[model samples]
Target chain A: MEFRDAWAIASKDLRIELRSRILTNQIAPYTLLILVLFGFALDADTQTLRDTGPGLFWVAVLLIALLAIQRAVKIEDDDAAKERMLLTPVHSSSVFLGKAIALFIQLFVLEILLFFVMLALFDLSVEDPLLICVSAVLATIGVASSGTLYGVIAAGVGVRETLLPILLLPVLAPIAIGATRTFGDAFGRVDADGWAWFGLLSVFAVVYTVLGMLAYGQLMEDA
Target chain B: MNDVIDLQEAVVTLGQFPALTGVTLKVSQGEIVTVCGPNGAGKSTLLRLCAGLLPLREGSAHILGEDLQKNRRIIRQDVGLLGHRSGLYDDLTVEENVAFWGQMVRAESNEINEAIKLLGLDGRLRKVLVRQLSAGQRRRTSLAGLVVQRPLLWLLDEPHAALDSDGRDLVDGLIHEAAASGATIVLASHAPKDISSPSGRFVTLAGGRVTNDINNDGSGDGVS
Candidate 1:
């Protein structure tokens, strides 16, 4: 697969997202609202909230990742755009990579915002900055790869709206656990086994990316 | 000359319904073929099959000498399809939509501009978003993208659907031009009379089967 073809697809998606401002105007605000709602629901002391902020941050990430995938898939919903991409000479794996990359970048930006929001809202402090950054990057890759794979899988199904969450949530459980635990280790709220959790997140990201590249062609046939 | 499309008793089933029930047809290089039928008569299915969009359920199907069942991915590069949908992103301007597909095919910038000129969208209209354009304008943008690809085979399903008289004339001209340049054309339409090319062949499909096949020379055969 030509890297240029993949870049073309990724650039096109990113440009569309930038022009529409859908992620910033709608999804990002919704994610922040989730963080605010969690704060209200916790209604705990600063120490308790700080201890729990890492877990809540990941919860918000998982939910917002769903919206990101949905928007990515919806861009192809009109005018048989997905078929147009599939019909190109470029390998189907490249198309999958391009979409996964785009979603990763969007989620990356969202995570940065959420990280700052968590810092302010819960009075949290990063004890291990490097571990937090690495964990967030690895975890975002994991979510984007798996989310894109399942997004296309469900895109053509009749029950796609219901099917996407059903297919994605179970698969995302591992990433959620690994990310939250890694964050805990970074913030010194738990024993420093940050490397082990980061390793798990990396494994999830690599496995899902390879799986998506291998399965994309077959999925296009049915999608 | 090599056969651009060769399907022998091709069967395509959509769920419980058979969209194409054993359709056998052949078209050589540089031939303009028109497929006309009612809504459920599978006119669109035949074009899609040629474009490698639909799976062949039974019988042999080959496009550009590549087996449809096995080499679908390879066959797709040699074919361009213009279906019911315009395939243009509403958020993208006319130029961006055309350039995106042009880049996909790696067409040169000049070639892309030439295609846009053919569709008469090279001026102020090119900067307008697709959602803001009229249906005919969107269709023109879709055609421009297809033109940039310059595939060996063109599968046009209702290419004249949302066009005005001038745009319809443009579609006819494009078909002839593409065919003259050795590109095989298979156009599906409910109203075949609008396509008035003298050198074209007409194949009438009914209930997913070809009922009549007529050549430009007026010689014809009935398919059972």
Candidate 2:
């Protein structure tokens, strides 16, 4: 019930992550690697590549975020941090918030890395800065809530490294599709139904956020 | 004797296997009861159910006169739980490790400081990571966390697995301290211990049911 309870968990995680920079640094190059690979697969077709580039770029970004998120999920168990956190009287909802925030920041950073990489790779232009940023933020939230929940689940029973992605991507596909279409609207210079996908991704983020908060205590209970 | 931890037909089941069947148990405010059994003897299950970590499939449990499901958080606030695993983060220093949990439970800084001293961790508080410490030291941090907050009930599983003679004594002392405060202690271990002078009730189980329920008569609690 403490106002700063969630921040307590969040600050601890952020502090530890800052102390060991390996966790975030690994994502930056991984984003670049995926972009380079995407370029090779697309080849030199300006017309086809540009039309699909926006969609593929976001897909690459989402995948990179997912990768980083999976690692973030395991942070608790890496050093028995999860159990230590559970022992506290802080509500489980706060724990979920702390973890979701950590992953959200990591995902946002990954998306930023993708934005720069896309500009360099294909001379990408930001058609609407506001819309692109909005879509990216929503997409990251959608990924962070769902990814952190599954990460907690996996951390309890299985090897989180393999289980996090498998559990998150399928559940988060709607976010990706929504992000793809929204980003495409910005790049294609049209505003057709972009708000629809925006609405959909927003709903996903809220639903998962609530689900993660309410269920984490139960998760800790059995595990 | 005023009952501190009393179970009334506490039946907890997991899928097809009945974990705790028609089990009746009682421990006074200053009593120490050790539940010993085989691997699948439901020792851990009973402790977990009491800790509100496991659900009661049938019957009910009352901790300090509070229902588990309806008042789980209140009970959790007053209970200290330590499972078979040390559950210590290997990367953080000992001070951070204890502080993190203490901060969550809102333990006073002075209480945490006293726990650190009692556990003999003041010298290596900031320098040693859990991974760098011996098993005994790692367990000691966990003990410190358990003692930092003054809980009315203590539910522990395999607490002395990695502890040395001195470490065991440390735990034994903490158990006595908690009981002197009218806290109920339920410990699950595989071996016998010589820490307390109270009436140590022995509950032995097999196939997830009480096989004998006897007092410290050395004949095993006649729980069968």
Candidate 3:
């Protein structure tokens, strides 16, 4: 696939998202709501919240990532639009990569907002900003790649709403663990090995990306 | 003329229900073939099969000189399908939708502009969002995109739906023009009057099989 073709798909999706304001109006606010709900569920204990902030942040991300994937798929809800995309000469893998790239951008922005919210609400402080940033970037790629692959897999089913999370969450569990552990080390909350966790997240990112490219063409037809 | 679409006893199943049962069809290059049938008679399935969207479950299917089973992806690039849906992004303006599809097909900018102009969408409507346009307008935008791609095979499912008399005529003209330029067309429609071109062939499908195959001269065969 030509890189230009993939970027065109990605840019079109991102442009639509920007014009529609779905990400800003609905998804971002939903992520903020999740943080607040987490605060209430944890009983307003700043110490406890701070201790578990990284884990909770990732949890929030995982939940909101579902919304992002759904929105991405929804844009192609008109059957002919998807058929048109499939009929294009661009490789099917390019379509998958394009959507994954768009999702990664949305999630990255959401993470930044959530990170600030955590700092303000949970009184969390970052001890190693660079490490936290790197972990977030790597983990976001992992989430986006797996999320796009599963999103398309469940796109044809009537129970896609219930099925996407079931299919995606288990695949993303390793990402959650690795991201949380690395974030913990970045926050100076644990003496755990940070590079190893970052490495694990990186591996998840690369593996899922490669798998998505190889599997998307078959999935697009089968689904 | 070369055969662009050749399906010999092609069978397609949707779930357990057979949508196309041992269907044989041949469309030559630059020929215009219209499929007429009631709902559930598998007219749409025939178009999808030619576009390589539907898998051939039992028999041979070839389109644009490529075997459907082996070269579906490559065949898709040369084929353009316009189904029931308009396929335009609601959030994007008419121009943007056409430009987006043009980029996907790697069409030249002049060709894109020419297509949009040919569809008569070059005025203020070009800047209007697709969602805000009437159904006829949306259909025109989709046809413009199809025109820009300049596909070898055109599979249109109800190509005249939701269009005014003028828009319908425009579609017919486009079909005739495309066929004159050596582009094969297979369209499904309920209205026979809409596709009354003298050079066109008509095939009626019923119960997943061809019921009537009539030529422009009105001499043909009937299956049942």
Candidate 4:
């Protein structure tokens, strides 16, 4: 029943996003533009871009994740839909899982887009494509879970847009670090242990997912 | 004969200013009660309290046999609250919105369809997005969502606002029908007489408290 409710919510959110085209029309373009500009900032230096591409890719992903989280929270706030949903029999944990699932799907797709863009622009290549995929999935899960939790926490405040980044960015630092190092190993940009960083990413994802499922109900009540 | 709502000296504060102060009221099942008040009289707050959306700062509240302080969240599924906003997703069509909310409450597909038709949201309007809807249509859509829930308690704040004459009549019929079917209703409105049924109770509120609780049975007896 919980999974059913979560799927219902996820499908609802995805449907709305499909209709709105905000992800394709607005946020995607915005993140891609940021990535392109970073290439210019490096003066189109091949070695420089290649060496920094992984970090830059994660940065773009984080920005996109932030926008995605805000958009998720705004949809609920637009018509007091969250409050309305609360009155239903669906559990708040279901709501949290549903939203996180939706976010994960969206962020994963964008990460793929951003990855190919990095490949083309930064002259990047992957030594271990599977590791790259694993890192992306883990990092995306971490972002979605933690971002969903913090999104609701900051939702009730008036200054959420400015406040969200401040609250979300610092917490996402470990993801940025872990995913970057993992990606670096995949790209052969550095010789560090990518699987070790993958371990950290996995822990982050598991911890946040469990915490979100447990705490979402209380956070929503206060939010 | 059981009391569906029993609030005693309930104080609900919104950022330090008490929205509901010392409000004592009792509502039984199968009753249609209209609460009339000026702006900022806590009419909305009272309904929210009964809906278990607001916590009591002082005193006690029990809605549908559940102590609010002990378990407000548990009563939510059985309580329906319609506030000033339509609470319908603008991006979703009328039919989609109704179906979405209905599915949330595990309502049957037939119930969802029936509610849509009952609220006049079938036909072309069913596919129309809520954002494109007029104020009246949106209210009807919201009402359809509420109907699908089939809640034990209906807390409507300004239920007649933004509705046309026919829409208002439709709402009145629904409210009466709901009361007749044993669902307790507490509606707050500015023009209480406009929607007040002959058998309904009229409660006037001011300054976060009830000033008059009177029966419409022509007894002229009021509890102040």
Candidate 5:
């Protein structure tokens, strides 16, 4: 309801992510390394890289984004977080917004790194790098919103480690699928109706963002 | 202005479990009331019900003369809360944490700065990450967060549970300030010994029911 509170809470999370850059930055090199390994493991074939590059890019983004999401939720995992944040004066939705912002920033940075890797490894002269950036941004928003929601629910479960990825896959599988379509359409010789996929991604972002803002007030109280 | 929170024999349930039942209480403007009891006494549940964190399965809950179910956004903004946890990010600076809450409540730009100064957090040392600070500092940030909202109602659950003497003093001072500012406070606490003041009224709960109510006359701090 209060717009001021939402921005402030979101900024708080962003500031923390900046200060603890080590936590979010850990994924960048690993993600890059995976892409490089894919290039080397595939016998340096250009056609194969083009065929699988889009899929590889989205998969790397998902896994890297997962690293940041887990760390963001874990920031409130200890007893001190319960004493401090779960009961603080700020709205619970504010907390979720702040963490989601942190997740988005982390994913955006990874996407940039992937751009360079795509050029260097595959020598893929894809037009409109910024278009992929735009698609990545929308896709990142979806990932952050969904991941944070599930992370909160599974924070205390017995099989939290196993439960998180398994539970998230079905909900987020479409992100990888849709994002790959968008990326391929931006540059590849694909003729599938990618605008519909982009539209679906946008709708997902709006719907989930609304659902999170509304339901989060209840979840934070119990957490 | 009338009763900030009015409950008429309200009952709340979680699925098949009973969290609150047949409970009636009134919180008016400019009042501080403590809900004290052992664990599972539903003291926290009572606070949640007043804050509209749970749906009322029986009776009714009204805030500022409006039904809680119909006017939740208004009531939530009017109510400030701090649960057992510190509810802070160790990585965020004290000022950042304060500013975050300030933004949520749409406080004036100076409100965050003033709260930081009021809490004695002006030095560059205060700009460091919360995780790097001491436990006392974290609690200070958490309390400063409430200052940003300055809500009409403050619902705290065991807010003083893990603090040292200084942290306890900080919380005590904040409560006094909120009460002085005409805020209605309903705080739930299991520990009775920490609170030595004899100003506000104290209500004790046992097995999910209010069993005793008495004014603090400096005669006794323990309700039961």
Candidate 6:
């Protein structure tokens, strides 16, 4: 029942997102624009661009994930859909899982697109393709779980737009640093143990995922 | 007779302002109770409290035999609340919104389809997104969603607002039908005469308290 409820909520959110085209027309374009602007800022300095590619890639993903989280929050807040859901038999943890699943799907897809863009614009190539894939998977989960949790926390506040970044970015520093280091190793730019950083990303994903499930019920009631 | 709602001197504060102050009301099963009041008279707050969405700072509330102070969350599944907003997702089609909400309570496919048709949303409007719907259409869709829940207690706030005459009549009919089927309804409306039937009772609110409660049929005390 819990799994079904989670899927129902996730499907509803994904359907709304697809129909609205906010991710495609607005968020996706905006993310690509950030990368394009970065490309221009670097002035075609191939070595510098290649060296900083991993950091820039994760940075873009983190920034874009914020937009995606805000969009997720708005879909519920608008029209009082959240209140209606509160009246349903669905568990609050199910709601959190559903939202996190939707965010995971979206961020994973966005990361794929950003990866290709990094390859093309930054002239970056993958040496350990397996490491890159694993890093992206783990990092996306970590971001989506943590982002969905923080998104709802900020949503209850009147000044959500300004509050989300202030609350989220600091918490996501580990994902930023860990993903960047792992990606740098995957890109053969750094001579570090990528699996060691991958372990950190894995732990972050599990911790936040569990925390979100436990804390969501209380947070949703307050929200 | 089973008491569906037994609230006594319930005080609910939103931030600093007291929204519901000393509101004592009781509603029995299969009763159609209409709450009437001006703005800020605590009508909506009363409905929300009955729906188990608010905590009482003072006094007591028991809905569907569950003490709200002990467990307001558990009673929510059996309670349906249709607030000022339709609670419909704007980007979703009418059919999608109704079906999604219906599925939340595990409403059968037949129940969902029946609700959509009953609300007059089965044909062209079914595919139209709620954002594109007129106010009346959205209200009808919202009503359909509520009906699909098949809740024990219906908490409707301004259920007739933005509805056309036919839509209003449809809601009135639904409320009567729900009451006849043993469902308790506590609806708050400014225009009470339109929604409350001859047998329904009217409970007036003023300054966060019940000013008067009388049966429209002028027979028994409103509680019974």
Q: What does TM-score give for chain A of every model?
A: 0.97, 0.90, 0.97, 0.99, 0.89, 0.98
Q: Report the lDDT tens digits of candidate 5 across residue range B62-156.
A: 97677977766556667777766566777777777677657655677798888887766779746777777776666667767778878778888
Report the lDDT tens digits of candidate 3 across residue range A1-223: 6778778888988999999999899999999999999999999999889888899999999999999999888888753588888788889889999999999999999999999998899988889898899999999999999999999999888788899999999999999999999998988887888889999999999999999999998998877
Per TM-score, the best of the predicted structures is 4
Q: Which is the better candidate, 2 or 5, if ranked by TM-score?
A: 2
lDDT tens digits by residue: candidate 4, A136-207: 999999999999999999998999999999999999999999999999999999889999999999999999
Which portions of model 2 show Cα errors greater than 4 Å? A1-3, A16-22, A44-49, A75-88, A150-167, A188-197, A218-223, B210-224
Model 5 achieves a DockQ score of 0.40
Q: Score the docking of each candidate (DockQ).
A: 0.74, 0.45, 0.75, 0.82, 0.40, 0.87
Worst 10 residues of 3 chain B by lDDT: B215-224
- Residue pair clashes in candidate 3: none
CA error at residue A213 for candidate 3, angstroms: 0.9
Better of 2 and 6 by lDDT: 6
CA lDDT, every prediction? 0.90, 0.75, 0.90, 0.93, 0.73, 0.91
lDDT by residue (B31-69, candidate 6, tens digit) is 999999899999998988888777789999999999999
lDDT-superior candidate, 5 or 6: 6
Docking class of 6: high
Best by DockQ: 6
After superposition, the stretches of candidate 4 with alpha carbons farther than 4 Å from their true spots are none
> Candidate 3 regions off by >4 Å?
none
Candidate 5 predicts chain B with a TM-score of 0.87
In model 2 chain B, the worst 10-residue window by lDDT is B215-224
Q: Candidate 2's residue-wise lDDT over B138-163, tens digit each?
A: 88898888888777778878778788
lDDT of 2 by residue, A141-185 (tens): 888888778777777766766766777778878987888888778
**Tens-place lDDT digits, model 1, residues B1-224:** 89999999999988889999999999999998999988899998898888888889999999999999999889999899998987779899999999999998889999999999999998899899998999899999999999999999999999998899999999999998999999999999888888777787899999999999998678889676
Instruction: Give the number of the best model, judged by lDDT.
Output: 4
Over the stretch A1-223, how does candidate 5's per-residue lDDT look in tens digits?
4455556555665666677776446677788888988888888898888777888888888787667777766776763453334333466676677667767777787788787788778767676566576677788899988888887777757666678888887888888899888888776646656667788788777777777777776666555
